[model samples]
Target: MYVVVLIVVVVVVVVVVVVVVVVVVVVVIVVHVVAAAVVVVVVVVVGVVVVVVVVVVVVVVVVVVVVVVVVVVLVVVVVVSAAAVVVLVVLVVVVVVVVVVVVVVVVLVVVVVVAAAAVSSPCDHASSSSSSSSSSSSSSSSSSFSSSSTSSSSFFLSFSFFFFFSSSLISPPFSSSSYQSVLIVVVVVVVVVVVVVVVVVVVVIVVVVVEVVVVVVVVVVAVVVLVVASVIVASVIVAAVVVVVVAVVVVVVVVVVVVVVVVVIVVLVVVVAVVVVVLVNFEAFNANYKIYALAF
Candidate 1:
């Protein structure tokens, strides 16, 4: 009975732990799903920001061109100087490119920060272990993974910003030939940044899916083991109960048989004693009668 009770207690504990792990896993899955939604929202916001930045750049360019052209025309009215017009146009284009580059960088930084935050958020690592030490180890590993991913993302963002800023500063001056070149470079940088962001998002998503899959698989295996253990425990308990009952029955039968034999032996001894007494008494009476007859 004691062994059965202990087994039952153990089964209950294991069941409770399994339930807790299941709840944790469900929570983790929900968190990951929310992260995914957050990523989508970030992407959409980034796109809108990019559009706004482009519009701002275009408006700035048109305004600068119109202002410079007007100044040049007024100068033509005063004293015609084609060289001054050319210089003014080149200066205006350079200023516009600089503004556009700054706006793009700021937008890209926003995107990077948002993406990094999503990746770095603590993921619930609900690992079931037969021991506390193993559980702690799994938790540490998960934390380390999150930290590494976060650091790598930060490094990538910094490197991208440095590259864009440095290349812009070192590139040729803004002129008719270099204008298209600079614009191409800026577009390329933007595209690369967007692609990198997308890739990181994909990697984070895959990690979440894999983690959830592993949790599910572990839960299934634990359940199967628990069921098997319970079955074995039940069988052992039943066998123990049967053996105990059989032993008690055998002991009772032996005790009754011993009591019956003792009773029978006492009865036989009493009957023998009584019969001998009656025979003795009758013999004595016959002896007396014979004597009396002789006297008569």
Candidate 2:
């Protein structure tokens, strides 16, 4: 009687386990169906967001071009002229080339993507279906050949390369850890560049301000404004003469030196502009990196 009772208990436990498994499976299926609906909704929202982003980018490009016409022309002309004359020719300053390449590459990306979506993809889909089917079937067979001699063609080709390609369109963007690393590095670089540019600009401004202050004091000595100005002006000029001009011929050199200050200021502005450009554009970082690498 005990043996019979134990067998009955075992059977009851098996039935309970089977019912629980069936209930769990049903719950899992329901959960998955809900998850699939949520995923579809998310994908639709993402598609709309992408379209909005593209529209915004197009508008921004148009507006920026229209607004920055003169400043763009000035910077382009001055930078181009400076870039054209290679200092020592040993310095292969390819700033123009780099700018051109950046612009061209961005334009090409826009063009190629537009052409691929508008013209080529539909044609490619029709022409390459058979090759795709054959490849998929072979791959499926290799992975699951041992399981069944009789499997449906649909079962073998459960995957579509079209959808595979569609997923790949943004899969790297959506699910890649590398993307975050690259973005973080780029942001860090940009921040560092901006900080460096601000510092350089501040330094240049301070230097220029100091020079202007000195020039103001120098001008005070040579003024004829109401005689009080004249006295101060005379004293400063006399001081200048004592320090810089000992002989009559020294006057010519001093005049030449004064004449050259205008050119020196222009050169200074150019240097400041260049420092601003290099720091802001991340080019100086690359040069420094290369130098450090060579040193090692």
> Which one wins on lDDT?
1
- The window of 10 residues in a row where model 2 has the poorest summed lDDT is 84-93
Give lDDT tens digits, candidate 1, residues 1-296: 22123223323332333233333334444443343233233333333344456576754554354345434433432232233234334433443454355446545643443343333322111111122344445566787765665565555555555543443333211223333433343344344333332332333334334544443343333233322432334334433443444344334433443443344334433433443454344345546645775699
After superposition, which runs of candidate 2 have C-alpha atoms over 4 Å from their true positions? Answer: 1-175, 222-237, 241-296
- Residue 270 CA error for candidate 1 (Å)? 99
Put down candidate 2 lDDT per residue, 50-134, tens digits, no spaces.
Answer: 3456575754453344234423433443343233222212112232233244335434543443443433344455435644555
After superposition, the stretches of candidate 1 with alpha carbons farther than 4 Å from their true spots are 1-173, 231-296
Error of 1 at 46 (Å): 52
Q: What local lDDT does model 1 show for residue 72?
A: 43
Q: How many steric clashes between backbone atoms does each model show?
A: 0, 1
True-structure RMSD, every candidate: 52.4, 36.5
